[model samples]
Target: MSFIALHPLRTFSDTWRHRYLLAQLIKRDVLLRYRGAVFGVLWIFLSPLFMLAVFAFVFGNIFQSRWPEQTGGMPFWLLLYCGLIAFNIFAETVSRAPTSVRGYPSFVKKIIFPVHILPVVPVGVALVHGTFNFLVLLAALSWSGNFHAHALLFPLLLLPLLLLALGISWFVAAWGVYIKDMTQIVPMLVQMLMFVSPVFYPASAVPAALRPFYDYNPLGTVIESTRSAVTGQSIDWRAWGVALGFCMAACMLGYAFFQHSRDEFADAL
Candidate 1:
């Protein structure tokens, strides 16, 4: 009897069976980030700490802005650090997504690879750095005497930001293969988002008329909710619900876009 060829479904099953390759690729991405750095992985922890110091020095002291009172005794630095951690994860994941697929042309050209897994590498690397940053935030808050029981909920609050990043990453990574300019554009967009999102200043500082804009942006609400969770403060559940809904929609749309464009990647590369 003639042997039957494997069906398309079996090809997908074979790809799923290669999940270990994806894990190794993610590990490689993480290690390659610090390959030549003197401090290696230590740089992950120190970079954000140094960032907080500069921000605190400039905004906390240079401008002498009064820290808002709603943080329930949490130091302004701690409040800023909480928001910083969440924003860093979002920024790092989205910024690097463009390069994730673009950087590995060999895999696309030569190997029988599952390209969809490519965008995941940056998110995995960012999560590793984020875990370290979270530990550092914990230590800082504990030292500042602002560590609350709610700090344990910080991970839960960050889920929305992670979802947002994943969605943006998939969309950017796919487009990056087609258009080279995304590499430059994504970072600039993230910088704009940082300023727009409540990283250096609280949403409370924004005028009421302008508050609606911040409420609608997923990044702002995620950052604010993350800060509140870490410090045992209250959050606007209505805004959060709206932001989370957008995040879920982004994730679905991004996945759809990525899957549709994925077949074109090898040709684009």
Candidate 2:
């Protein structure tokens, strides 16, 4: 068997080396999403805004939701949007990961293609949508006079999440190639995670007993930190640092697992 380096450096280098192919795949994925639509590429901006309107209305208007950790003049919807966007990035990526590689058996069969990068494509696509969502968020915050320079830290906060999502993507994408059940299982997990995470409520609302697990969970940590950034509050760097370390290990371990199982993908597909 050919040796596959599982180091974090190796994952970064492999991704950088295939930057062009990754770009093309990302482009294709984005374009294909709105290919036949009347609004075409415009929906990228509209889709998120539309959803935000619905969520804001449902929660901010009807439910009149107020967060336990509410700060400044930030409205309920904006608070929800801030954390929701962070969670959406992870959810969007991992939810699609299962089919990222399995859907394209041609790439797996092609000797010249790099199949290892398939899972990474979903992360790229998620970032694209996330960028637009962030922009929309900034516009909303600025309009509400809640915009702060700290909001710039939004992308910075997502680093750990992107890493965690990518690692899980690789592991799930490979399993999906063989098991097929991951398609159904992964989304259910994502939905369950959304409710448990701080995407809707503030992490402060959780009781002291459960606070540690909630904070340590990379998913909840990112969302909580991101909300802090948007609200111009202090972040628990110690917790953020721990989450980053855990996510980095996940990325490396996931890469290793994907490469180890690479030989079997051809047969499975």
* Cα lDDT, all candidates: 0.78, 0.89
Candidate 2 lDDT (Cα, 0 to 1): 0.89
Question: Which regions of candidate 1 are displaced past 4 Å?
Answer: 1-19, 53-64, 68-72
Model 2 residue 206 CA deviation (Å) reads 0.9
Task: Please give, for residues 1-269, the per-residue lDDT of candidate 1 as tens digits.
Answer: 10111233432353357779877987887788789999987897898778767766875678755566453365566677788788989999999889888898888776567777788777778888888888888877777677888787777777778778977888899999988999999999999889988986788888899998886788888888888778688867787887877787676566667777777777888
Give per-model TM-scores.
0.85, 0.96
Pairs clashing within candidate 1: none
What would the per-residue lDDT of candidate 2 be over residues 1-269, giving only the tens digit for each residue?
12355677888898889999999999999999999999998999998899888877998789987777555368888988888789888999999999999999999999888998999999999999999999999998888899989899989989999999999999999899998999999999999999999887888889999998896798888898888889888988788989999999899888888888888898999
The candidate that achieves the highest TM-score relative to the unseen native structure: 2
> What is model 2's C-alpha RMSD?
1.6
Task: Give model 1's TM-score versus the native structure.
Answer: 0.85
Candidate 1, residue 269: CA error in Å? 1.4
